[model samples]
Target: MEKLFKQVAIVVDQDDALVKNLENLVSLTREWQSSFHLIYVVERPAFSFKNIWKGYANGRTQPFDTAEHRLKEYQEKLKKLLPEGTRIHCYCKEGKPLWLIRNYIHENQIDLLLLLQSGSRFKRQPIRFSQLVGKINCPMIMVPLHKKDYDFKNIVLPISHELPLKKIMIASFLAGKKNDARIHLLALQEQDAKRQRTENPYLFKTYQLIRDNTTLTVECHPVDGDNLAAPTLEYARKVNADLILVKPGSETSPPGIFHRLLSKFNFSSSGIPVMTI
Candidate 1:
């Protein structure tokens, strides 16, 4: 059978903590046996004659070369963690990260992208994982820097009428692979009374789809909240869920300082790996 994620790409960074988490990710996805590609982009600064001359004069290693070295190190570490004979390739480039990564995904037909969420902050400086949310063609998994180990035993799938049911299948596929895994369908309660009544059919249909399609144990519960992310994450925490299956279009609070502070409470900061599928 064809694998769910046949071609997987991981965005490599210099964060030591995230690099440590690679072992956990590799171990978790061993079933898929997918080809893993590691990509590291060196953010290039504006050209300056003095900088170039200094590098040439001092024989300092170029930024691209440095990126290649780091990525090779990552490749070696992953090689040790991954099963023998698994395909691994490394790409080191100097350019705008967002552009390069998107292009790479398209050009290489990456089925899934794994990115590292740096140290306790949802919005990291210089590189924000959220920026690539809807931009990439394929789904991406955001693994928290502090997340050392995990199992797909308890997978959280927050369902709402507004969101697509595609994630249901993805959740089921993952949960079905592991021993004794369960999928929690957290229905987002609509604040408006009229909309709440109208949305029940969609919720029930989602529940039925999971029941008919997969044998994994399933649970459904109503979650109350206007901001979709907060309640979903809160429930995951309450249940001690192992993984959360989120979407690229998952709701977020308005852009402001208050929202920034609240974002810290989201799944990325909780050291839980969230798959934005």
Candidate 2:
């Protein structure tokens, strides 16, 4: 990993679904030695009677009482779950969840942002996540809420034109480098049958780059499909991959087909975790 993710931030949604999977996030930070912060946002009440409200002796109000108590419970549980001596800080905010998260990231200069795909706050549905995917300044990894545990023994990496190589290799390392994982590279080939017969030479180089760097058992598969996402997901299932690591377009570049598909994607429906850098 060229740039160490020394600081990580996880946005716990209103449901706290992702907070339940805190172990998975902690395990990711072990290698990087990143200290993470757990952040929860309480949406501002639809209507507030701030002017007429009489605060308690301590100045705590009734509307925010439940939110404060819930956050305290989460903080206690998370502190117990984290490794010994690991620095962890928890915060609760009141505002739009998305904006609060963005502001927090900018203020803290977080190196990585971890999020969960399952939650009730997503009234805007996939578009909400798509907004984050399109605009997050730091690398973000979103894990779908699933009943199963993560093995991370096999990772399926899809390679397309202008793939984000640096971010991807870093993510693969963090997700599975120590697990002795095998990175299966599924190259998205053009649909035209006569256009190409051989694998892209860059695949070998990428394999070499990852393998040499991490000693990971990197392999490649040529997938001929109309689009990258569908076949990539299929091949990922075929390999029984633990995670599908992708690199969304950078802020400077236009949104790619992958990013476009991700905007409308319901990751939980796929039953696999998708980590993007």
Candidate 3:
């Protein structure tokens, strides 16, 4: 089947590892037959010493010579890595990384945004990217630069009763385009298996939907866990999943035990990448 996303925008940074990771992601997208765009947001220095003294200074403001130079070097590297005749574009913006990326997605009509799992500058506080989850309309894929494994053969798609199944299905289809990839539609049943077998009709409905639409191998499993993250992570490990697709729920709500558990399961720490839909 043809790729669902015609255009994929990758947000680049100064980190070499991140650039390499983005290149791999773009390669996968191209294998699925999608166009790629590379963007590097050149942030203007906060305040130059010369600009601080001058009143209403324009020329005194710092020039993006450093940023432009770095961007050019990365562009060359990316061009060499990508296949010949691949369409690639770069943009340099002076603003916050998250906002610039979000705006780029909107203005360019991008179908998907590929970003390094954690920003180059903010590694300790990686959850900051989670803020953009609700803000952006298009789905974002976070790739861990430190990991060498790229094969996404086994995938876990966590399903809850909250979000629309259509959205999850669409995202899953885009990520797992190949027929051989295994997708597990996991649902954590707070109750026992016997009770859940009789109670939850949505589980069966989701299973039928996947079976009817896609050729990929699909399985449904009911887990026993009071906290959603525990069962999800356990199953992911058991299946040796390469990716975990989850829907970001309300952040303002109090952090339940499940939410806390998820916070601990850092994408950087886990060899598998987590894609929050």
lDDT tens readout by residue for model 1, 72-112: 89899889988899999888887788999999999999999
TM-scores of the models, in the given order? Answer: 0.84, 0.75, 0.77
TM-score of 2: 0.75
lDDT winner between 2 and 3, please give it: 2
lDDT of each: 0.72, 0.64, 0.62
Per-residue C-alpha lDDT of model 2 across residues 1-277, encoded as one tens digit per residue: 5546777887764455656766665665556667778777655544546532532222222345666777677667767867677777777777667787888888888888877666543332212446686576787766665435566777877776654576555646555545576788877555346775666566667777776667677788876644566666677777777877766542112257655565346443466776666
Off by over 4 Å in 1: 47-62, 119-126, 177-179, 191-199, 250-261
Sort by TM-score, best first: what order? Answer: 1, 3, 2
User: lDDT tens digits, residues 50-89, model 3?
Assistant: 5455512532222466557766776777678777877777
RMSD of 3: 5.5
Write the number of the candidate with greater TM-score, choosing between 2 and 3.
3
lDDT of 1: 0.72
| Candidate 3, superposed: residue stretches over 4 Å from native | 20-23, 43-63, 118-128, 162-179, 190-199, 250-265
Compare the candidates by TM-score and give the number of the best one: 1
What are the per-model numbers of colliding residue pairs? 0, 0, 0
